[model samples]
Target: MPRIRSLFNPSGKMDKLVFVDSTKYGNHTRRAPRPGLKKGEPALKRQFSRTKYLNDLAGELNSAFRGIWPAKKSDLYQKMLKRFRKEPENRRGLLLMQLKSMEINPRYTFNSLGTCSTTVKELEESVSVGLQVQAHPPRGKYDANTYYYEVILFTWDDPNDTAFWSRQYSDWIRIGKDYPNPVFEFLFPKPSGTTLQWLLCLRVHLGVEDVVFPVLTTTGMQITDVGTFDKDEIRILEQRKQEEEKAKKKAKAAVDDIVRVKAKNQQ
Candidate 1:
């Protein structure tokens, strides 16, 4: 094969000559055109099937979270396809695991501003999402008062049934003051299936001279089997309670022994 340094023809074809673009060689010529695969070949069928499945899964994810953050849609699509391709056997499980920790913005995380603890509870009629945010005062910016924050609660029983709730705080957090904890209860019917997932998004905004730029970060979790979830939570609480009681008894015994020793010494 001969490499073409500069070609007048952009199409890479002129009558009998055929040109190919290769990363290794800028533009090269092949002696004869390679034979194309037959229409019903097994290898070709498998390739097509795999591509279709991955594309469908990616499309479903994009549709589920459509319009939540338009700027990152393309990146999200590519990432989902890459992940599905990597684990062909367990695409759905792997994708859900990956989404739990996926960062919306690579530059900064939501925890940088403050700390947030999220809890999801499954009620008989609805799901309750409780968020406790401890926001810190502005740093690095001279005008701290111009900074504000927003919180968005996103939940879905199934991909088709999704909900979003948002709240904005105009006042900046001051030192030695408490940031209000917000609890948003989403009225979503219990999933017929066993699992539910929710995503919490935090955005920080800086306004200067009427120009505003927002930084976003998101974290989410999946709850499978409501019965199992409640049981585990109750078990954990009971264990902690038992441990605390044991510690209190030990401390009281030590105090009583110390008092007896002091009395004996004085006598």
Candidate 2:
């Protein structure tokens, strides 16, 4: 006698999940274009200007760090000081962490884009940004082999509405070991009253696998303080993540909905 196995699982279909941590991927090898000099001018002049700007910024950060670490007497600063002590070798990293704690805005130049390089230009109503994903070899055996990356251009309007992520652009780019880099252009809708900022979101998933969830990676054109994001907005983002997870748990289609949208557009 043998135990009879059920044909279907009582817990329902299992969702396929693949998490790709962008930080683990590290930065791309390709370099941004350097500022060029005319025939008679020397390159050192431009170099000196950049170095001077960096030094000034570093000095400002150092001043702020000193004000908080030793001089300020507070429980929060005391805890931070303990962590800061651990990074005795990495001054720059410690400075960045301090800046984050202080809610300081990061300097975002036109060259902030990662492997997917972009350029920004001013527009009448919306900002225009061009994205070009650079092709590269897969990281490891666990890396996705057959996948389509989705690009969503979004603008946050009403805080109360769950549909704040009104998809301005919905498209997908198929990628693998040999796929070519895809070029995409998006226009984020401008907001009305307050300052309007546009976010470009990239998500990827296996095209052939059913019950699969997407791995999201995002970047934006606007340069603002990290701590400025509202709690309501953060809640909405968390809700979006939950919805994605729920969809995966209940997904029955072989190809994800995003891939279908791209294919439908092609037709």
For model 1, the run of ten residues with the poorest summed lDDT: 218-227
Q: What's the number of clashes in each of the models?
A: 0, 0
The C-alpha lDDT values of all candidates are 0.49, 0.39
TM-score of each: 0.46, 0.29
Highest TM-score: give the candidate number: 1
Q: What CA RMSD would you report for each candidate?
A: 13.6, 30.5
Residue 170 C-alpha lDDT in model 2: 27
